[model samples]
Target: MKRRTRLVSIVLAAVMLLLSACNINMGESKEPAKGTDSGPKTEVGAQKVVFWHAMGGATTKVVDQLVANFNASQDKVQVEAVYQGTYDDLLSKLKASMGTNEGPSVVQMYEIGSRFMIDSKLITPMQEFIDADQWDVSQLEPNISGYYTFENQLYSMPFNSSNPILYYNKDLFKDAGLDPESPPRTFEELKIAADTISKKGKAVGANFAIYGWFMEQLFANQGAEYVNNGNGRDDLATESLVNTEAGVKVLTWWKDLIDSKAANNLGRKTDDSKKAFSAGQVAMILDSTAALKGLVDSADGKFEVGTGFLPKPEGAGEGGVIVGGASLWMMNSRPEAEQKAAWEFIKFLTSPSEQAYWHINTGYFPITTKAYEEESVKENLKKFPQFQTAIDQLHQTKLVKATQGAVMGVFPEARQIVEGAIEEVLNNKKSPQQALDDAAKEITAKIQDYNRTVK
Candidate 1:
């Protein structure tokens, strides 16, 4: 018995030593990421590239189809597509794999993660490949390309881009005696419409989820900045502007809907609000353009859906929605051959035919203007005219500082802080001004921490 106990202790000590050497804890596993796949039997000597993405649900099928098509189209490269859970989860795994061979050759990151990805020095800028290949970037949509461009260079290739828009039930609008053809365009107008709809008792006026992305969009819609220093374009941001007048106005208006019984406090899960809207429990809701197809299909026979621009405060000017989707980034840690192969896949994915297929199957806007000329996209537009609103909004937007959106290394954390602040206001725990001020202080500290390390 003594010898057995001693043997067990020896094994435990050896395990601890191994863990320390690997820089991992017992609580963590070195397993392959979820949804990882070994590429379909590749041709001999084919370059193998691994792609990490956060897309799930039916979208995974589309990604797989695209990969299959790419693989079949060429014999030089075979790519394996992996789903790495949420954006936060994928980023965590990448951080863990830093300086190791476990990192992917290509990864999809959300738009707000641009600053962090750039600062990490882990990505090969898309501009490098574009210059090497002499590709014509002029074919891309200006508004979409402009979002990923910084310091006069494109960092990543835009994919699955979208922005928030107002969705309402046309049938409910008629029942409330509101104009079904014209959805509300301003905060005051939206409020009145909501009240009228609620008074009829058919449904609540609106149920905008307490999402920080929406708050950021609202600020941009009012030509307001979420952060200073040219929205972190000209220089690294050192302060947050969440407590500005525009911020206060947004929270006040959002809270007023609940207070006046025109809208419900549905918490922060957008899916919950989306489900309610589809069920006719709510007359209006704000959601990503990417959700348009799902929402319309869900409401097929139940109700007629209508789309409108994101509402802003009265007298606000020269503002528009920021691009609200993810982009494909090539990693510098990959081998030259693998990186080149990944670039080819990126180009193929953004081609007119693929972009049109993506745009029609999913509700995301195509990043390239030429995709609109594709027969599939034209037929899709005819089938669902609501989609044209998103396209028109993107083109009409003035590419200014506010509409360009903010960039910060700590954006993901800052968004969570802002969401918490919104909760405080909605729950009557803090006034909008006070909640925003507190949230701003928290976000500023995080930005300072991130800046220190990057600098």
Candidate 2:
């Protein structure tokens, strides 16, 4: 009986040992299985960057093609271009997005928004990157570079820079008994031609769809400084020469044009003005060269169009017209790698070939000198001589200065005030001097408020 009991205990001990070994094996198997289930990790590649732009239509297509080409050219980066609406919409969206940390890596900013962006600290100075890369900025046009520089440091790169040019309908000019080939070279000649066309032509003699652009060019052509110290970055307390003799003269001329029915005052919207011109309601227009493509498209081969340099004030001498176009600004919310990639994409977009393509396709002036020298651009220019009008005007400009391009904070609001003043004068509600003086005072007050906040 004792031997049988001992055998039973030995068998139970062996069974317990086997159970313990099985448990040990099961525990060891779990770790390898867990690790294998985790799967192979993906190595993160080039950072993806998002850019917000206010370009659409053919311009957007060009941008898409460029982005695709850039991505295909390199495996280290991918750039995505997003259309964020008009210039005003972009600004509003950007201001709203400031509260959140979800802004884009890059943004296309308007010329007037430069000061506001700088004051808000929303943009990263591009000069830092240029310095770090040891880039040859000398290759860029000095006037274009000057447009983007703030306190000697460039905050953005001028991408689609353009100046206003005079576009006339050749058929209308001939009908008005004016030389079709001889465009107005002076404001006096423009007034005469406009008066003649108003009597004979089917539409208004002359029109300027964009008031701020017209005022900028008018001030520059008259050799009048919009702000003191030559740099537009100064304070409102400094002085506002916008109501000076030259200003009053230009304002009066605009009033005379409207009063005489030589020119019609279309609403402030670009589309309104474009519609009027396209429908042959306006014989001539002073508008951005960027609109050349749209004008041609709208013409439908119905009229012979001629583009020429903007007419200057009589005896004002040759002066530069301020550039009016969008610029690419680097946002502060991006990572360093993404910022570098954004810069690379900017370089690609501004490359000679790319600039040429854009200029030919969109009618925007090439931002780089190399583009002007490209064989493709030359051939294209030969085919469309009007394409060179913007370039010629830009080259002929003298003494590039900030006074030519007003960069005051709250300039967008100031422009609205000025436009209101212009409307008042056009509607005969106020005299030219009164309207402009009121506008000047209002703009100065806004500038003061902006300066106080920024300071």
Candidate 3:
């Protein structure tokens, strides 16, 4: 009995030792315990920072890879990327979060919302951070970051910047007896080609995905001021100037296309318009360059896609298409350390390699000059020269005034009013001048109400 008891005691001691060794290894392999600084202690570190964005698919993958690269490149920062839905959804969430002080450290915002973000004070001025870091602003494209600047202060960093382009189905174009290599350069040419294609029953004429963007580009191309002083900023009177001779002319042209059955209302939804184009239901589409990946994917090697510069007004001079894409806005609600981390992440994202990746993957123009100089970008550009169309357009931009691209306040509602006006004109419910005049009045009222609140 004594021998057996000694043996049992030896076995229990061995088992306990084994368990102790295993526990030590497990602890080392696992993350540091809460409140415990298991890794190297570093100054100016954040525990974790959250970023809210609306990017998805290939773009989302690119963002994820960038986040992973950033996390791996640093020891003191960990970033959590959260998808917050569409642009509107992101704004709604931001507003709600601000009310409760629960917003993310960074948010991806659309260009139209830049004014609102600046006015709300929801974002911090990025210029201060850039100056403090002594970052190389020269590495970026000139005035590329300026799109998000309001009142001479940079509120956000340009991320996925893009402009509308004319995408055509090569197969459809050929079927309609149009040369795929030679795209329409003027509105009249586009109309003629669209009419021919529609007559051939190969597809509907030309359809625009975003009516607002199309209108903006049309106005710019024709040197028509959408707002007084050509800036889309300031008071109601300034914005109401969109109800002008040039504006009426553009709207009238749109109405004529629909009235002649050369074009059809593909609906305001971008996806629907894309589907129509991909399925050969529509031969031509004016949409963001960002949609290239989707169109390519959905094409599934069935159709050849061609991209070209947006069609110009018949007598319009060289003009720039307004930039339309999202930017990265750093939130003020986060801890200073987290804010710094967020800035670092932003830098990583805007790095040349990341920008190249984003541009190649999403069809968005790279905001960094280094990205344009990179070999990968050069190779892609060599193969697809049309990809540089947006950059070329930017070079000729005059940037008339804030009201041209800096309208804040009730823009979302105002856009709806404008769209309604577009619908009325297209459907012949009202003439272009009458429709735009009515829209201007409605939009003016909304702007007044918004100004009252802000004042």
Candidate 4:
């Protein structure tokens, strides 16, 4: 096999100059592109680049616009975008495509897929391209970028960035005799508020996705690393530290939510809990910032949507939320021309105008700082005031390896083991301490297994 060492560079001045062409018309004259054509694209000849992603429906609409904008702006690159199902499905297909030589030139990689992608050795770091071109990355969000940085280098281009935030129903709050404007900011306050809602019977107090993602958020919020070796940013992780003081406290607190009937326990299925929020079955919920648009559409004007940052543990301060969502990874083992063209398309996608357009259409956090100042973003924020909650969460986050999350090769597997423990606690089958201890052992073995293979 041959190694492709060539990487493309971008001129910041020229990229800024291209901003005018990237200006997204709130309503473009041409009909917006659909699934697959989203931020990922495909086309025939003329330096074709096939983009595979895991976005559909509403998200797809915005992706189409981005791809259309990029393809229309240049003649040398004809990009074809395809929707490849959920992130898991995309990862599976991507892994399977390794031997096919006909794989996509670019792919949308979920943040959790970071280690697997790097281990697969099929990707070319976005840093290489930036360094090759001497492009300034000052515009990228630092905390968000931290999630992808490993061994002092960025591994992918952050895209569709999001983080967990508290979503509450204003109508339910008012009905429960609570102030809709003042949401809970700490665990004690959250319990009080939920207790009020539960007793008032306006709605089920709240619902939680019985998953490890929020656990990771809670750990980060209190400045606790999910894995050893500085959460794998300093070096490869060797074990799971998810049974720490912060982790145990979070587990106990979440279990208390169910025990007190303050939170609906919907197993490990996030979508089921999401539907519960949209159906107005719960007064409050914790979910991703990217869910705002779908949630608004689902509520259908039945009630006012409200947002707030995730509640923190007592005595925790200045801690922060980690960035979720996916990023763009340029695959290697291809022609240098295609690699350059892919980088070109990626540069356009991350530009200010495109980011603002993406933010308005998809409720994703804009990667470019200047995107917030763009007219389109301003107008969208005015129209959807609730969005300010997510923006604030993004701005307030401090860069820490804990917030950036674990970077181990078995991170996905680690998440599953932790989620299983959560299931045990919620179902009254095990105590938080016991469940967490058991999960830690299993995850440790998995990590050790991986390290042995890699070594």
Candidate 5:
């Protein structure tokens, strides 16, 4: 009990630290773009729709532009886009505003929140809108949308989808006498490459941020379940599979790199590790496809950036990545007219042209396959082919429970626990197996607590 209490305290501290750095003013709204016209005057009696989103930094600008375009393209709906802080903050605020007018007509939530959103019964599933309009969901990328679909029903509209890929410094690989074209495909090969690079004095061989999301992706890539009961897809999960053989192998490989001095322990912030890679401090790193643009730009004139599939253990089979990103969900408590207006805005934001602009500006996938056909998308792809790796990896992923991803009401806390376990292993405070065993047990208890309350 003392150990569990300590873990919870650590997790809460981590959450507070992250929230302090990321949370923003809830009243923030986008400024109108300069040199852009508002297209047409809004129709009198236009339905007002409020949209709450968690987009931050430059991506927030793109989201604002998308909303601006949507409002200008039509006169019947006046949609107001508001920045609602980080994903954690947004969800918490939504809960606080339940049954109140302060809540939004539509909200963008992180992917892991699906189970909680569904169980809350506060959302109007996107499936209903699709069915009402006879909308063709087949147009969207199935692998990307697969994560939001539960019980054969899509609970939300996929947006800004991404997955992890291996980013390496080609110049470092060349300096280490390795082929720049062929990246390490398996765990053993990656370790060897890292050692070679370190031994050659080119750069630290690698540094994977101790991110829990990466842990989940690694488990899926090995066809391993992060939790039991079919990765929480078939039913509510009763246990975690974090201590499975696949989990141990992955952690062992990660620790091997650090132990041999081939990889540096850059801690939990992925951005710090990314900076290390861009500054030539590391030869390789694992990051989201959404970082492609920034990475390529940062490495400009320094080194050629190379991207590869997320490496797996030797002989692992039939595994692939789960989509990672946020999705749009409609609020059921809103009036029918507001709900319909929000649906129009959703469709407009996901249109081919908008998605192309989004794809080029942000490294997120277009979600709609047709977005690839846009001229801007084609030109962007031609300019930076590394982006193709993310798309290809997504398309190649097999749609299954493991890849579909685990769902749970307590996912946010569970992630912190898993990350803590990883930290314990990397710090040599606990063996990999022991750390995972503890995390799985702790998470299962949290799940049980959550299950009891929700029931």
Candidate 6:
């Protein structure tokens, strides 16, 4: 009893010290209150902030370069970026490390993971950090940041962002006697072009990666809901709305293309369909704007890549694209100094110059509006006119919950379930309506389980 009492006292003392050091009084509630502004930054000696991210391959090179620039720009702080596999892998590792002292000071979590991050209460809201410096975020494109804002407060900083776009082969278009400049803007027109291309044997009419993300975007394009409770923004989501009549239309269109052999039945991995396009086996594809740089590099001599706005469901919804990407979050469990250092790194990364460099190197769209004005960004756009399609799409987006995107704790799992349904339809194992209904049933059960834990 004496030893146990002593250990309890020690633990309480440590908790008090942590709370006081970060400017919180733990006597009030368990909720994480804001830290003090602490005035201007004072130089701290070689403080290292660990950032765990998910970027890999060529994009990882750009991430490392930005880190090098940030380190060279400052003497007081140093950032060490550690690659933690894909976004799904990163989220799993982050969850496993929560509340442990060994966790990273910062992490890059995708938009779908934001809901879990908030409920976990393991990170400082980026808005509080911004408020400390009284920084203005007016330059941030709302279409991108809107997805991260919850209850009127921004929780994470938007980093690499993009929306889906239609990528087509100009050479195929010319061969089919179709105008390369006038690609399809609606589902009806896409079929017309795909039919002509398939009949001509130039390549498979169109190819899709069987990605649930694209399916979600298709619903958003038609102003449809993927989940209930205003996409889990107004409150926690309890059921999925993705099995609706209009929602099934998306799956039907995709399934029909595969059945008609107009679109290749590429697997769930985005890379599969991308490789098909680069090899000149597919005439057109639908994928993220983040693929712009790689697509150009891979298809440099093979064919001219032409990009256009994502095709809308024939005459429906307010025609907009959902901005998708990961965001940088500062975990609040560490000392206040480390948290501040992480924020410093994030601020530097989002600056116009760094963002312009990032945009030129990787295909991911920059969140900062001023980045487009940079000479480097201008030069890149002049070299690759295909990028302007994404820029225009971003400008035309309206901030509704449908366009802002759905956020739920189980969204990652939800995506997997939807992908399975897509496979079934493509393989002719189920009808569009039957596939969606079955997926909705499974997703609804999972949502109920997830909500129970939160409550």
| Model 4 lDDT tens row, 33-128 | 333232322333357777899988878878888999998998888778899999889988988888665678899988988987888878899899
Backbone collisions counted per model: 0, 0, 5, 14, 0, 0
Clashing residue pairs, backbone N/CA/C < 3 A, model 1 = none
TM-score of model 2 relative to the true fold? 0.86
Candidate with the larger TM-score of 2 and 4 = 4
lDDT per residue (tens digit) for residues 1-455 in model 6: 99999999999999888887897533432212346422122233566778899999878888999999999997988788899999999988988887665688889998889899998978899999989998888888889889899998889999889899999999999999999999899988898899889999869999988888998998888888789999899999999887997668888888778778888887988888899999999999999998987898899988999999888777787848888989999887877877888889999988999999988888788789899899989989999899999999888878898998998889999999999998998898999899999999999999999999998
- Model 2 CA RMSD to the hidden true structure, in angstroms: 9.5
Arrange candidates, best TM-score first. Answer: 1, 5, 6, 4, 2, 3
State how far residue 86 of model 2 sits from its true place (Å). Answer: 1.2
Ranking by lDDT: 1, 5, 6, 4, 2, 3
Alpha carbon lDDT of residue 31, candidate 2?
17
Error of 1 at 125 (Å): 0.6
Give the Cα error of residue 77 in candidate 4, in Å: 0.9
Task: Work out how many backbone clashes candidate 5 has.
Answer: 0
CA lDDT of each prediction against the hidden true structure? 0.92, 0.78, 0.75, 0.84, 0.90, 0.87
- RMSD per model, one decimal: 8.3, 9.5, 5.9, 12.5, 14.6, 8.6
Q: List the residue pairs that clash in candidate 5.
A: none
Candidate 5 lDDT, 1-455, residue by residue in tens = 99999999999999888877996434433322433322211344566788899999998999889988887887888888899899999999999999875688899999989889998999999999999999999998999889999888888999878999999999999999999999998999999999999999868999999999999999999888888899998889888888899889989999999999999998999999999999999999999999998999999999999999999999996899999999999998777777888899998877899999888998899988899999989999999999889888898999988999999999999999999999999999999999999999999999999889889
Can you list the residue pairs that collide in candidate 6? none
Give the runs in model 5 whose Cα sits over 4 Å from its true position: 1-43
Q: Given candidate 6, what's the lDDT at residue 260?
A: 84
Candidate 5 or 3, higher TM-score = 5
Find the number of clashing residue pairs for candidate 1: 0
**Comparing 2 and 5 by TM-score, which wins?**
5
Which residue runs does candidate 4 get wrong by more than 4 Å? 1-45
> Residue 300 in candidate 6 has what lDDT?
95
